[model samples]
Target: MSKKKKAKDIMPLLKDEPITEKHIGILEENLQKVPGAGKKGIEKALETLRKLKGAKKDETVNWQTYRNEELKFEFKYPKELDKQFISVVSESWPSWPPKMTIGIDATETDFMCEENPNYKDESGYGERERVKINNAIYCVTSTSGAAAGTKYVNYTYLTIKNSKFITLTFVLSYPNCSNFGEDNKLKKCEAEQKAFDPNKLADQILSTFKFISQ
Candidate 1:
């Protein structure tokens, strides 16, 4: 008599097959049910599925890539983000075109990112936190202020890459998320702001940044 087809038996058949998050979820749900060798096989497949998910996300975005051969670094960003040069505009003075950018500077700065006593204003450089992104840990310094009643924000991502200390700076300026009168009537701000959120975009781009040589 032949044995029943188990998950381990089906895993080999999944080779080169496109797996979705739903498929991954199902596998994770059943992972505990299987024991021994079958369990190990599913665990390995789950890891592959997760990597495939990340690859699929990158493919769907079709973001533009920026590579600096001299620095051996590369990153990607969306087209909507590319056109950003907008500062919150007003009637008295038109806001200048958005100048969204990820400015980078490589220096031998301190790795600890210690706060300077001279910098009395806590808001100037709020706090330093260590975060891991793109397989590299960075000392992130975030600062924010208001300009003409608009929110002005900056992020400094400092890390050491290829034996050189590097800093990636990101800036964002956006008016408060509100609905004054889109259709001539007051309404609440839309709950979804993912499409235009610069901060979210910055994090996405940061994930794509890496040293090609490494």
Candidate 2:
């Protein structure tokens, strides 16, 4: 009889453990090994790692606003479509200080305030919706489209739940500025760069998740 390969025979299988500081530190070291990886380069690399790791957390990201800029991204939880809320906030990109906010519930997420109170008419709104699936939540959200010279931007989001676990995703900016006339053409524009893709962001956001007891 021929011997069969057991599951244990699988080499290089992945684990569900959370990312450790050690892993990030090793990555930093590798970056330094690259040519011309100076202090600034290392710092930028570390910052990128921090952002990537930070996105996986369940806490809200407090951000700052700018003259006329808007940004949106998703915040996911630990575990596969587990019980969690997604947050998508709008703010300036490459922002001196990030203008960010968090909504544990996407359906109720709000639009950001503009610099000028009078600009409210020109400001935008954010939206979120949810659905359920077996043992996992599949969500979708809008991201990245801002009205010129306005602080507020429209947003849409989705959430899903599976059994005892639920997962929520807040898409800050997708399907931007649908309502536009020839005059408002200047007000409506395509999505900005640096904003994470809704679907790709979903995967990346969920990749760093784990279930935590309430």
Best candidate per lDDT, number? 1
Tens digits of lDDT, candidate 2, 84-173: 122244234322122223335333233222222222222333333343333334433333345453332332223321121233334242
In model 2, which regions exceed 4 Å deviation?
Answer: 1-145, 149-167, 171-196
| Candidate 1: count of backbone clashes, pairs at least 3 residues apart or interchain | 4
- Give the per-residue lDDT digits (tens) of candidate 1, residues 116-169: 433324446455667665466666666666665456656666666555565566
Clashing pairs in 1: 85-97, 85-98, 85-99, 86-98
Name the 10 consecutive residues with the lowest summed lDDT in model 2: 1-10
Alpha-carbon deviation at 23 in model 2, angstroms: 29
* Every candidate's lDDT: 0.56, 0.36
Q: What local lDDT does model 2 show for residue 83? A: 16
RMSD of each: 8.8, 17.9
